[model samples]
Target chain A: MTIQPAFQCERLCIDLPGAPGVRRIIEDLDLEVGRGQFVSILGGSGTGKTTLLRALAGLTSHSSGRAVYEGREVRSPVPGMAMVFQDYAHALLMWRTVRRNVALGVEGRLRNGELDQKVQNAIRMVGLERFRDEYPWRLSGGMQQRVQIARALAMEPSALLMDEPFGALDAMTKASLQDQLLAVQAETGATVLFVTHDIEEAIYLSNTIILLKGSPAHIARRITVDLPRPRDQIVTKELPEYLRLRHQLFEAFRHEIHA
Target chain B: MMTAVNAPAPAVAGGKERPWIFHAADNVWSALQGLLPLIALLLLWQMLGDSRSPYFPPPSTWAAALIDRTNSGDLIPAVLVTLQSVAAALILATSLGVGIGGLIGASPALARCLGPTLEFLRTLPPPTIVPVAALIIGVNETMKLFVIVFAALWPVLLNTTLGVRSLHPTLLEAARSLQLGVVARMTKIFLPALLPSILTGVRVAAPLAIIVSLLAEMLTLMPGLGALLLMAQRNFNAAEVFGLLTVVGSFGFILNAALAAFESWALMPQGRT
Candidate 1:
């Protein structure tokens, strides 16, 4: 029998307390994410992209319908799933060293030696082994973001929910981190639901890009990226298919904005 | 390897290491500069004052009186008693403040409910309650401790509450997502984040702890430096009074310096450069 999808959101709706009564954020949204698949949710500003991600992570409750994780209703954060937030500085414990921060998720669950190895592997995956003893606050923004990712990775979750994790970094750092994230996913085979507004970044990193449109948003299009694996930043962008997909997304975004 | 280390490296002397004695000398020089005016006034008073003056006794007279106290059996024990009360009160205040502060800070409804009564209690001067406390609790070590804790707890509680309120929302989310249990949340997350602020509160409260304990001792006449100082004044022993004042001032100075050193070390970021 085929395994169930990692997450399924069925007719999910969410509302937020606004200045003018309660405002609807997500309406009648349905989505299914397969295990080990890389998907990026792309949207414009104020389109409830984050609200959807939060609902899936079980951080924010839905007004109606359901968000299902591994065939169970998700009303709160569940085991075997971890979230990497955008604000690395705030997300990380500032007082903890890189090694300790990475260990935060899985520290008490495993034995001391097992926990140490998991933390070490995660640090090595993010290339933060050299600065293991240094506190998170002392690291640069890119390094700090890596510390957060490593923290999530150490949990060894079946699925990773990331919300604009690399949005705060400069171009060089963002590109490098994207490649590192792809490699990490390949190794762990964890399903990823990444949320971002950057068109090029979504196309580069995801196997499928879900373009979100309109207020109280639902997915407007889900485009599968059939590009070759072991993707190179320079070579992949130069590919005609990659260029076509990039153009297609830009056009979609432009058309949606005008509408 | 394109490992770009963007963080600023910590400052080091770069060449041969300077001897620690030189650093010590620099600190001593600065401290001496700070004390110069007081030293000058004391020296002038010692040179100009009459030996048998009823008032305005010189530093020499104060020193003689201090030596006399040392020879007597009462001085050391009184100081020890005062120190004990201050230490106990401070310990109690810190624990109670952090415990209650964390709860109130985490819950908006709790803070709102307790805010009025706490504000009212906070406003009533601690010393003003001492007599009232003595009447109710009776003048003993327990009453003394209660008075000092009441006086010292406000700073720590206020600081810890402020610390908790300012905590990053994402940190709690991170903790929750990690499936960290309640005990782990407090020990690992809350305590570490609130530490610097707690230390700040304790620093402010330390002086209050010492002062209030002394006040309680004086009011009760329960055998401490406070009582000794009052007794000396009542007997018109000007020299003894001056000596005791100097002793208290020295204790305050040393306590403050020790706390500052501890706070600096505790807050020092590890593995810089």
Candidate 2:
């Protein structure tokens, strides 16, 4: 059986205006993400990874081509799509309570009672029920990131786009959040397109990985993970298959650099 | 499950005291701190004045005159007039300054184009325009209001613009994503974000407002505390001059304290730091 693409970027190009003229950031980029699939886009710094995410989120305009959601061309962010920004501090509104921040996404869409229920559920899902009434600034970094996740989940988007959500975290926090994200994705059955530079994180959390190379990014390689659900980090990292896949990805990345 | 990090042992001498009381104590302490210099100046003035000199009245003579004026309602009307000018000018300045500042802050091109001109306007000494304002308005209440507005507007306007411009982009993005309507966005995001800076500006401008209003009154001779001081100066009644000075000082303290109180309540509903 052939899987249909949930998100498709066709010949998308981005132009960033400069002093002289408009400079091209990304060109002739095409990508696909399948439904309910956890896809990781791995790229080095300045490879237009963030610009691509911004275009997908409809925050940045593309100079040419289309980003299609399901089969429809996406001109702007629709209700079925939500994004998690890289900066946890910037992700949630500091002036608002955790519940209010989470409820912010679905404002005007749901009634007060329904919104409260949804917010509660999302907070509970992220294990932030106790901190629902606290402001974002008062919480620890990991807790704040969880609140960001809760906010995205509360939006109830069919697809969640994360831009290096755990990059700012320490190793332990990053590992924990990775597990939490995997669990959230599994429970909600929401398709996720997460961008990361960490190869191990991509391998452990993603079902499919697409590696983008250089400026005006092109797909350098793609890998598929056949790992079972509820994968243990320690056990999985020790597995020969995981090590072999890691080595293969490392080689591909090095080859792209040399090329 | 990190008990040490999440939940620490309570270290307390006492607990369950009213948090509001501590806030009140803090306010009182700061108020006393502000008043200390004024009190020292008053003591020095008293020491410099000999009891025999008519030109330099002693503190006791000034105190007696202040009490006499208060009892006889001699300075009441003058105080009221000064208060009226301050109220009018403050209302006009805040409304105009905040509105104009917000407009300028929101538009980068406009701010850049107009910044130098605005800076030049601010640099023009407010008192220099008093003569022009007096001539235009014919030594009426309008002249006083204009001078007060002229003096007070710049600080509020500049601070408000800085506040608005410095607003965090993430907060704006959050507001946009939340679909907060225009009015809601302004009130919740812009207004609240601009408030602390606005308060600082207003506090700085409050004394200037009083000073300008008093000066305008003195020039116009329109029955204000400043005019009363001018009358005392002309008659060489040092006691009355010192008395009125005391009243002005008290009024300044009251207005500043009132602003501080309002700021405390408005900006921080959950215990000010």
Candidate 3:
């Protein structure tokens, strides 16, 4: 017997309402994400990578075709699934302190002091223990984003959907958050569906990278990262194999830019 | 990356570093700007006017009569009655407005159904309906409350609806994705998003509530500051009348001070902008 994948999309088509009329974003897209896999969807500007992630999370409806989470059809946001929105400031409840914001997903659901325990653990995971009592608005942008991530983690989600989670950060913050994300992923082993336009980020984080291109976006390229686990920012990125992949992907990106 | 070491230790208890007394003082200064003309006029009246004048008694006589009223004990109770009614009406109006406005704002169908009726009623002055209220609810405190609440409800309701309409789409999406139920969504997501506008509405409605409370008391001859003023007027006690006006003005000042503190506390939890 075969293990069921975490997410499966068969001919998934998405049409978003544009100014002129209904515009197709993604059409006839097929994907199979195995359990605990880190799949990053990469695309240029205006590509439907984020839209695809939203569709998979059942945030936005697909025009046609089937998108499934685990064994169930994706109609609404599923249980055991959490999303970290790109705009952390807007996504987070500004009025809530760090602890309360992190506890949002599991606030009333957990019992017997489990809720507090989960909130504390998630805050600790994101290294925001010192700022737990402070409002998200008081924190720096990167810290605010960490609160968003902690909020998702508190859910103890089986599958996590992230849309350019570190896109807005400075280089140092981005690098640190990337490693922290990897550490959390190693510990939790949650299936991650990440969306980004950064080639290096996609290469570093994902087990599989799905490059989306064109207006009615389709899977233009699918690249698999066979790099060893415990990937490092300094060491893994400097490896000969990693360098080779980087050179090839950049060339593909250059061709993409002109085409 | 431990960047929080220099993260500017934000004052946790108070949103601002300034003392609350000073904060209230600052707000009082701005509020007093509009009343400067009245204050100047009163100072002039005190400097030139005689104490025996029936129409333009000196400020000193106003104070004397107020002290007399205080000694007789009618002043404190009347003030308390007026204050209580204003507080109660405000709470009721805010509750009704936020609840109903949130519902209407959340649903286009409901907003459409009620929009026309609300427009018609909100514009028709609450005082004009005083006779209708008296005929139906009778000349009681309930009728007074109903009229005040009706007057004050509009600002909060309309502001809330606008707030909900302009609410960040991403925030709604986030709430939906989190699977928050209707009640939770309102209290946590909707309330905070609409808070600034809600506060704006309440600020506009507060004075209106106070004035309407006074109006109802005067019109119905109920036991409040308004009725006290009416009695003094009928009895031809010009000193008491001027004194009561001064007392009302002082009470308004105190309430404004209280409002400053309340606004600071309520809005301090977090700020969107």
- lDDT tens digits, residue span A125-239, model 3: 9999999988888899999999999999999999999999999999999999999999999999999999998989888998998989888999988899988889999999998
The digit string of per-residue lDDT tens for model 1 on B116-187 reads 999999999888989999999998899999999998999999999999999898988888888899999999
Extract clashing residue pairs from model 2: none
Off by over 4 Å in 2: A1-4, A18-21, A70-76, A255-259, B1-21, B37-49, B137-139, B264-272
Candidate 3 stretches with Cα past 4 Å from truth are A1-3, A255-259, B1-44, B71-73, B271-273
Best-first order by DockQ? 3, 1, 2
Best by DockQ: 3
Separately for all candidates shown, the number of backbone clashes (residues 3 or more apart, or on different chains) is: 0, 0, 0
Candidate 1 lDDT over residue span A1-259, tens digit each: 6856998988999999999999999889889888999999999988988889998998999999989999999999999999999999889987788999999989889999999999999999999998898778768999999999999999999999999999999999999999999999999999999999999999999999998888778889999998899899999999999999999999988865596
lDDT of each: 0.88, 0.82, 0.88
**How do the candidates score on chain B by TM-score?**
0.87, 0.85, 0.87
> Between which residue pairs do clashes occur in model 3?
none
Minimal lDDT window, size 10, model 1 chain B: B1-10
B1-273: candidate 2 lDDT, tens digit per residue: 111222233432333223333444567678999788978987897788687678777788988877777788768888998998898888788888899898898899989899899899899998898998878887888878888999999988988898888877766665665556788788756786777878888888889999998887777788789988888889888888978898899899889877876777665432233
The DockQ of each candidate is: 0.61, 0.38, 0.70
